[model samples]
Target: MTIGLDMMGGDFAPLEAVKGLQLYLSEPGAPANIFLLGDEAILRPLLATHMIPEDRIRVVHAPEVIGMHEHPTKALKEKQQSSIAVGFYLLSQGKIDAFISAGNTGAMLVGAHYSLKTIEGVMRPTISTIIPREDGRTGLLLDVGLNADCKPEHLNQFAVLGSLYARHILGIQQPRVGLINIGEEEGKGNILAQASYPLLKENNRIHFIGNVEGRDVLADKADVMVCEGFTGNIILKLAESFYEMTHRHSIRHEYLDRFNFEHYGGTPVLGINKPVIIGHGISRAPAFKNMLKLAAKMVKSDLFDQMQIAFRN
Candidate 1:
């Protein structure tokens, strides 16, 4: 399987992307077929300087890069040679089976959604990435920024989609789905969360665990956590901050290594017609390459078609 990576999409650009690529290569059983998309003029020397094998990696020269400051829609429309844009086009054309980008999040979202389109009947695509929890098990959070507002039906579909992801990726047959809310009680949330609970419960497509509070996210009450993009993003930010703050005292300790968000690589923009994974803009080479392995794993596991049917039902 081929994973097309946008080398110029993030804060560190090609350098950090090279780190992630190294991680992917070092991983046992990782895919070696990678298409690096960015300016070859700068990248070639970096590869030479690092003594990275030229035969194992391929470079697709893309001149322009979609800057973080550029509007997503406008850049996607006008920047034909943009790294992210061209990488996504390669994804659509099947020259590359999956795509990994650490560039502009908004541009990645916009490009992936419209370029690949959503699965039939999916209103908005989501970013589902695995997060380390306190209880030794990880959790899945969706709509991390894909849709600010969601209806009962959309949340219900997210539940199904997330469950399928958990099952396939986490290897859970009956992954519990939770609706994020202010309280766990029935009808204890805002109009959106309250309304989503009933539909989630009624849906036989997934195993709904009713409502779970943001505090329970790290506690591992449910395997697949569901919330609107606005709420989910806030929760993710807070959890990340808390994790880092709590680990501040043990920064030098090897035994007490805190969970690093970078270790999980990137979040796949779920529901896209093809696999499109988005890494943190600040991602270095290690995280970037793991994101490529993830896309390979997704294609290998057939999560796209599985989710397409899971929600279709």
Candidate 2:
């Protein structure tokens, strides 16, 4: 499978991306063919400096770039030759199996929605992040920042999507699904939570295990935490602060270290037609490397196919 990398997306473009390719190539096993999208003038010299093999990588010349502050839809339309736009074009044309970018998040989302489009039978596509549980295990949280306002049906789809992702990419067989709520007992939480609980309980697509309180997020109370983006994003940001706080005070702990976004790479737009990963705008080489690895795993697992089959039934 060929993976597309947006070489001009992040703050330290070309250099960090080239170093990331170097790190990925250093690992054992046959790596996927990579299509590097960026300005040929800048990327060629860096590739040469890094001594990247030409046979394993192909450079696609993309002269423009979408800035972080630019409007998402506008930038994509105006800058057709930009790296992000070029990457999506390649993905939609089947030139690449997956696309990875650490650039403007808005442009990436806009491109995925319009270019690849959402999978059939999906109400709305969602993004998910890996939650590092306290027991030295990992869990998945969905709708972290996408679709802040959602219906019960959206949460139901999120559960199924999150469960499928955990089972396939995370290797968690029969991952337990939980609705994030204020109370563990039935008939609690706001209107959205109350409405979603029944759908999750009744749906056989996921292994629903009732409500999970905020405290359960860090513990292993549930393997897949389902919530609307509003609440989920709050929890995600709060969790991220733990690492920042620790770093400020010079406190070092193994569990807190896992909170680093670099370790897990980037989060994928879970319900898209093709695998599209969005990394942090400030991502370094390690984060970029991990994002490529994650894309490879998702492609190998045929994650979109599994999701389609599950949603169809």
Highest TM-score scorer: 2
Each model's TM-score?
A: 0.94, 0.97
User: What value does the lDDT take at residue 42 in candidate 1?
Assistant: 84
Q: What does candidate 1 score on TM?
A: 0.94
- Tell me how far the alpha carbon of residue 61 in candidate 2 is from the true structure, in angstroms, after superposition: 0.6
lDDT of 2 by residue, 62-150 (tens): 99999988999999999999999999999999999999999999999999999997878899999999998888889999899988999
What is the Å distance of residue 69 in model 2 from its true position?
1.2
Query: Clashes per prediction?
Result: 8, 0
- List CA RMSD, all candidates: 1.8, 1.1
Off by over 4 Å in 1: 246-258
The 10 consecutive residues of candidate 2 with the worst lDDT sum are 253-262
Model 2 alpha-carbon drift over 4 Å, by segment: none
* Cand. 2 TM to true fold: 0.97
